[model samples]
Structure formats: C-alpha cells, structure tokens
Target: MRAPKSHVRVALATTLLAGAALTGSAAAAGFAHADSSRAGDANIAPVGRADLHPEASPLFSVARRLPKVSADQVLRLAESQVGVRENGYGGGTKFHDWYMNSPRARETVARDGGKVTDYRNAAWCDMFVSWVGDKLGIRPAMGWDAYTVSHASWFKENKRWGTHPVRGAVVFFGWDGGKLLHNIDHVGFVIKDNGDGTIQTVEGNTGNGKVEIRTRPTADVVGYGYPVYTA
Candidate 1:
C-alpha cells in the first residue's frame, strides 16, 4: 500500500522522539508536537560525550558545516536531476518527478514490477545529490545515506545525533521502536524548530508528494540523524 503523507511524517517524528528518551507515542504524538529547541540549542552550544559503543562509527562531524542550504536550492537541485524512465507507482506530486528518472534507478525498480515515479524513493536523494554536487561542484552524497545509516545505529548504539537537528540534517525512522530497520526508505529535513516540542519538517512523499512542510512531534523522536559533510 502507498504510504500516506501524514503517516510518513508521523513515522519520522516518532522515531526521533523515541531517541530523545521520550516514552510512548503520546509523549510526542502527531506532527504538531515535535520540538526542536533541544536540537537548536545543541547547535548553539555544541557538547561532547564519550562514544558509548566502540565498534559503531561516529555521527557525521560536519552536520554544522557550511550554511544550511535553502529549500529553494534543494528544489532547484531536485528539478535539475536526470531521471531514468521505468515503471511503478508514482508516489507523490513533486515537480522534481520530471528529472529524477535515473537510468540505473529506473532499471532497478523495473525489476520489481515498479517504475521510477517519485523523488521520495526513486533514488531521488542520490539524484538530488548528484545535481547539487555537479552544479556547486562539491562532493555528492553529502554523507546523507551513510550518516543516516550511522545515526540509526547511533540511536540503537549510542543514542544520539550528537548534534542538533538543523537544516539539512537527515531525519530517519523505522517500525515503531526499531531503529536499525531504517532503510533510507523515508527521509526528511529539519526546517523549523519550535520550542514547544513541535517542529516544521520539509519532507518528500509528504502531503501527497508536493514536498510540503508540516509540523512534527519531537518528544517521541527515536533518533536525530545527520550526514557527514566535512569542509
């Protein structure tokens, strides 16, 4: 079944709250309850903690590096991506759908009886990175995927993004309480952090695929993940 935009936001928020030592869904229920002051505060006042898990990799060190890119930049980058045609359920209503059809992405989805249709899941993140990297002439991936993977593990292992949920920080989720179950299947970016445990998140596949910005519950956050983008 196709995921609902509201549900996706809920899922993403739920995971982050759960990470903040918030208990139960009620602690940070709904997109309206997400707060980012703690995250924002961390950005203003960076702190350090011992790596609880020796084997686990650290959270991306460059989450605060460079000014956070604007939503327009992200959109422009997304729109310029080259999409590869295939077949599947077009997930959302994003305009970026016009350019995210990566050849390899299309080929992979076609094998699953699906086509590359939406930016949220069509390897669009990679495509977005590709476009932005080539245009800005910087390294791609921005450590988005790797940081997400590690952050999911960090919440499971060390239980921290080790930083604040700033713009460009990757938000991740899983089945209720399962952190490692994260597959980059769902992703969003922090846009605004209201102090009252609520946040505004600009996410893909949200609000029927229009890249809508919505409020999220922060107290139930399971993890605050980030990508490494060292200068």
Candidate 2:
C-alpha cells in the first residue's frame, strides 16, 4: 500500500547519502530521485552527500550551517513534496534509490533481516521521514530509520519521546489507535493540533502513493519525537 521516488531528483543527490551531512540548494530536498545516469530530480535538487558521517555530527548537522533549525523549516520542506507520487511500479522512486544506495540500508537489512534490495520497493513512510531530515541536514537531531517501531524506539531511548502534540513533533501511529509503540504502524511530521482531537500532518507514501497532508486523530498517535531544533 505504501510504495515509493524516481529520476530527475537533481544530479548531486544520485550518490548514496548514508547519513552523510548534506549541503546544496533547497532543490536537494525534492521528494523524487535523480535518474541512474545522474539526470537529477525533475522538480527538485537531490540532497548531495558530504564526507562527514552522521555519527560525526551527532546532532548539530544543521547547526553548523543554519544555526537555527526550526519546525517550520521541516514543515515547509515536507509540504513542498505534497504532490510527489511513487513510481507506479512501486520500487523506483528516489527515496528508494537513496535508501537502497546508503550504507544504512545494509545496517537496516542486517538488523531487520533482509537483502538490501528488498528495500527497493518496501513500505516507505519512514523512509520519507528520513529523507526530509537528511535533506535538511538535520538527521542528527531528526533521526533516521526505515522502520516505524525502531524510529519511535530511538526517540524513547534518546529521551526525546513525549505525549501531547506540538508543532514539528514526529508523530508515531498505531492504525488500531493506541499508545503502544510496538503497535505503531505509521509515522509523520506534525503540522499542528486542530483542537478537534486531530492533528494536521505532512506524510510520504500516503494518499494514492503520493506525499500528502492528512488529518489524523490523536487517538492513533503512540507518541511524538521531539528533535533538538534551535530556539
């Protein structure tokens, strides 16, 4: 149901990012991928990889550049991708290409037990989240992972987990609707609390296989992950 980015995602981003610090124009944040020949994304610049690994940056990857990371930045970048659709074949988008090419794909496959190419067409809601942060050069604070459960667990382990919706929180969900992280089936970035028991969100791999905005009930949220955004 949730399938994936393909070509023209900008030339620089064709290479594997692998938690590498990213820098370049805002186009690098596009939701699609550069073609195999490095044609780049048609609508956006692909996020280029910097030599510095994620471990090296820890949490201030964007701090070195913007010095003031905000949820709005994340929202804007995510919102810009609203109409992005996955390749109809289900395995050909840039998100898949990016993740597949990454060293993290191996780590994830080893931990999750699968071949790296299995991710070529895997459910990509989490990958979408990872892509957004990676492009923003905030993966250190934003965190990145392919599985929703592991990603949510990371937030808990880091002491960045919380209840209550806040603008920019990473919201984990259980389709059956509850607070059990293990039951979490999906994830998205919070846009705002509607005060109607729902929150507006921007999500990838949703709505006919395209990135789209959604209104979800709080009852479905397991918890929120707070990133270390600058004040």
Candidate 3:
C-alpha cells in the first residue's frame, strides 16, 4: 500500500539529517586524532638525550660541564700551538695545510693573491688566526683574511674593532705610522690583560718563526678585533 506523500517526505528528511550528523561526528574524530598525534610528536626529545634517564644524562651533572667554543676556548687552542715552528723562511707546512683546507681559504687566497703552496713558505701570522677562527666555528664573525690589513678592515667594517684589551680578542699591530686598517702587519689572540696597561698574547709567526706567547704594551697595539663569541 502507498503511504501519504507528506509522510514519505518527512521520512526522507529524517534520513538525510541522520546521515549529516554521522558525517560531522566522523570529521570531529579525525581532527581529534590529528591533534593527539601532534601532541605525541611534541613530547619526543633529541635522539641522544631521549634514551638516557634524566639524571644519567651527561647534561645532568654540573661538574661535568662541557666547555663551549667561545673566546676562552679560542685562547686555549692558540696557546696549545705555542711550540709549533716554521721549517724555514715562510715554511710552516702544518699551518699552511690548515689554511689550505679551510672553507674560506680559497677566498682569502684570491683576495690576498697567494697560492696554497705559497702559504707553506709564506708569512703565516694571519693564517694562524684564520685557522683558530675556523676551528672555533667563528670564521663568519672573525674572518679568515690572509693579510692583516684586510682582516683589520673587515673588523672595522663590521664594528668588531676595538682598542682596550680583552681576552680572546685578536690584536692587530702597525709598526709604521699610519692608519691601523692600512698598516696592520700582524695579528694574534690576547691571552691576558696583564692588569698593568699591557696584554700577554699568543702569536704565531713571531720570534725566529715560532709560535710564542709575548707581552706587548698597549701603546704599540693598533687595535683589537673582537669575535662575536658566546658570553
């Protein structure tokens, strides 16, 4: 028997509404699942730190604090190379190899007009500074110019140039009476302030072609190039 048309219409409308409700609930469940997955991902830690108990991790101990690569580390690294010596006039193969292999060495060579082999038999005071900066991961801020004049200019341009002595600062020298940016002849890392108007520095390519720690009066220092190191 055929039902009334109004009755059939009401039944059809009811079915459509029921289907829409079910579709909305499913969409909400999918959204909730996605949110839960994101929350789980957020709880995950770095690989090495995640496996260890919180107290067992090396980062847990204050006594076992790792030294960050900063100014202090740079000074220490430079000091460690104190006994390194050149074989002859402009002959420090170790220093040369370090400079040659550096990421910025080619740029330095191009700017300064020197070959990789020439560095082995070249003035390497600047090269030593470049090597230290590269090793410490501060090359972008410290610069790796093969010439002191060029390095000094970079410092001045970047506003890292200074005068007062600070540990780990690179000290540029100018023996000639002219502008420091133009006359810079050598560079080194400052070790101490000396507290008496002088600074003790660890310099490469000094005194018989050997790395040496020397004391220099502040008056003789042209200026200092400060690296952007972590405080």
Candidate 4:
C-alpha cells in the first residue's frame, strides 16, 4: 500500500524538528509543531514572521559579485551541468554533482567562506544552499533537511511562496517530476527572475559538471519557500 498523507505529514514534521535542533536555530516562522491536519484545508492566508528576513538589496550582493549572472546565466549553468547517470530510478540524471566535484563553484565557496558562497558538500544542492545561508549569516541554513522541512511546513500552512526571491528561498523540485511521494531532492537559490515566468538559479550537484546557474520553467513550480538568513 502507500503511506497515508497523515503519516507523511508526521514524518515531515519529525524531520523538521530534528533538523531544527541539529542546526541550533529556533523556529521563528510560526510553524513550530504545525498541525498538518490543517494543511490545504482552506485557501491559505498571508502569514508573516520575524524570523524570515524581508527581501532587500544586500541579499543579492553576493550573487552580483559573480559574472552578472541572470536567468540565462543560470540556464547555461544548468545546461552545462546536467548529467546522465545510473540512479535508483535506473538511467537517470544527477543535478547536484557539481557542488561537490566542480572546481569553480567549490573554489568560490572555499574562498568566500560564508561571504561569497557556502559549500557544505561539493556535490549536494542542499549543502550548497546551506553554505549560501552561512555566507549570508543565517544559522538554520546549515541544516539541509531542516531548511526543506521548514519550507514544506510553511507551504502547507501559508499556501503561497513569498513575494520576491531572496538569497535562501527553498527551491523545490519533484523527486520524480511532480510525484509528491518521492520527496524533494533538489533545492537552490533564485539568482534572478526573468520576469517572463522563468527563473535563473545557482544550485549545487546540478550534475557532475560543476556548480553553476540553471533555468527551469516556473509555471509548474510546486513550491517556493524562504528561510531566515539574516536578522
């Protein structure tokens, strides 16, 4: 059979609690112990919290230091990074390989150290975002799973992604492409909004190629979440 939605919610909640504890960051999104039973029960209303920093210019400064990367820049990064590999799903693609193995993105994170980029792992997008969170000085950003769980809770409760992209918006992708049962495997930052329903992002493990920017269709986006990276 399949795990009931309630079980999934409980598992997700447990993951969030453990993740938050590991990162030593307090739950400020007002989602602490969110009752998943209430999820999607109604059209969500706008909810805000002090933990999530508001969008601002300084948030984009770190990305600007790079080569003026835009949506296209991110797309090129993804295009160059896409990899054909054998995975649990048989011949599959691995998008996060670059964060661990790529010399360019790794070098950027190593040199910057919580300033330019944070590279938690050379090959995982979650780690890449964790490093980015550190560069931006957000403590909870370190826990890859927590970041995801928190965002999931936020979405389950709020019903809409935040207004604008910040440094650490939880970028979610379908594990098997819209198969919610697979859980989310990819996450990253919004490098730029093309303003035409496309977004450029810098993510790790985009593939064996390298840590780079890539573009994906936002029309089918399942989730867009943000984390408190700064005060």
lDDT of 1 by residue, 1-231 (tens): 122232122222222211111223323332223233334324422222344221132232223333444434544454443242223344332323433343433432332233345344432332333334334422211321212343244344323453355554545543254444344344455565677876666554444333445677664344454433333
TM-score of each: 0.43, 0.72, 0.67, 0.44
Compared with the true structure, all predictions reach lDDT values of 0.37, 0.66, 0.59, 0.39
Number of the top candidate by lDDT? 2
Backbone clashes in each candidate structure, one number apiece?
Answer: 34, 15, 1, 17
In order, what is each prediction's RMSD in angstroms?
Answer: 13.2, 12.6, 26.0, 12.7
**Per-residue lDDT over 64-111 for candidate 3, one digit per residue giving the tens place of the 0 to 100 score:** 122234677888889999989987776744877786675445544444
Model 4 deviation from native, Cα RMSD in Å: 12.7
Candidates 1 and 3, the one with greater TM-score: 3
On residues 1-231, what C-alpha lDDT tens digit does candidate 4 reach at each position?
111122123334333221233222334432333333433323222224434332221212212222222233323433444343324321122323333343333333332233112222123455445444333333232223213433454343332244455433556665455635235546666666678877777665554534666786664345666442212
Model 3 clash pairs?
A: 90-121
Model 2: per-residue lDDT, tens digit, 1-231? 222222112222122222433323223652112223322213221122232222232233333333355788989998998888888645567888888887667656655565778787788788888888878767756767777777776666544567868888888888876677666778899999999999999988788778899999898888887765664
Worst 10 residues of 3 by lDDT: 10-19
Flag the better candidate by lDDT, 1 or 4.
4
Question: By the lDDT metric, which is better: model 1 or model 2?
Answer: 2
Clashes of 4: 17
Q: Which stretches of candidate 4 lie over 4 Å from their true place?
A: 1-10, 15-123, 141-143, 146-168, 179-183, 229-231
